[model samples]
Target: DAGITQSPRHKVTETGTPVTLRCHQTENHRYMYWYRQDPGHGLRLIHYSYGVKDTDKGEVSDGYSVSRSKTEDFLLTLESATSSQTSVYFCAIADRGNQPQHFGDGTRLSIL
Candidate 1:
């Protein structure tokens, strides 16, 4: 039970709408990441932040964006979400670069 939480555990929306998922941590870890899990693709990184106001895009960041203004929170936004964006999103945090990451349960989102 490391300090991590994800909001909107379940959601369903239209294909052209916007969606925002949230990740909150209480451990004040310096590394936070957003990833999406698909059936056969495993986990693909969407974005990450190493510190406040310091963020970077990841492999599958085409339609996603993220922000880390405070040490405890990280937000992921899907601009004009599509059916292709329907998947399970997870939030993870690690204390150091090579340490094991702790993950939030997940956010299951679906776009019709």
Candidate 2:
């Protein structure tokens, strides 16, 4: 298994409200990433971290932020929830950049 777990499997909120999703891994992988999956968009990267306190913006970074204060934890936050941002967010872990990644179930977010 991936040894990855995502919190709040499902969530619904009003537009403009802030939302945060958590991803925790027991594998202690060096790379942690956040991505959003939409109907036609597939998976779009939001952010990634290579090590503790080391992070980078991804393909769709606007209105979103991420933090990796520890190797086992990664947090993704939507500063202000919007309808366009409603989607299933997934977290992936990779031991190395070239290695295959493992993914968590996902967090389904809905904005009204």
Give the winner by lDDT.
2
Clashes of 1: 0
Cα lDDT tens digits, model 1, 1-112, are 9989999899999988889999999998999999999999999999999999999989999999999989999999988999999999999999986799999999999999
Error at 112, model 2, angstroms: 0.6
Predicted candidate 2: what Cα RMSD to the true structure? 0.6
Model 1 alpha-carbon miss at residue 98, Å: 1.8
Per-candidate TM-score against the hidden true structure: 0.97, 0.98
* Model 2 ranges with Cα > 4 A deviation: none
Instruction: For model 1, state the Cα shift of residue 43 in Å.
Output: 0.6
**Candidate 1: deviation at residue 79, Å?**
1.1
- Clashing pairs in model 2, backbone N/Cα/C closer than 3 A: none
Worst 10 residues of 2 by lDDT: 95-104
The lowest-lDDT stretch of 10 consecutive residues in candidate 1 is 93-102
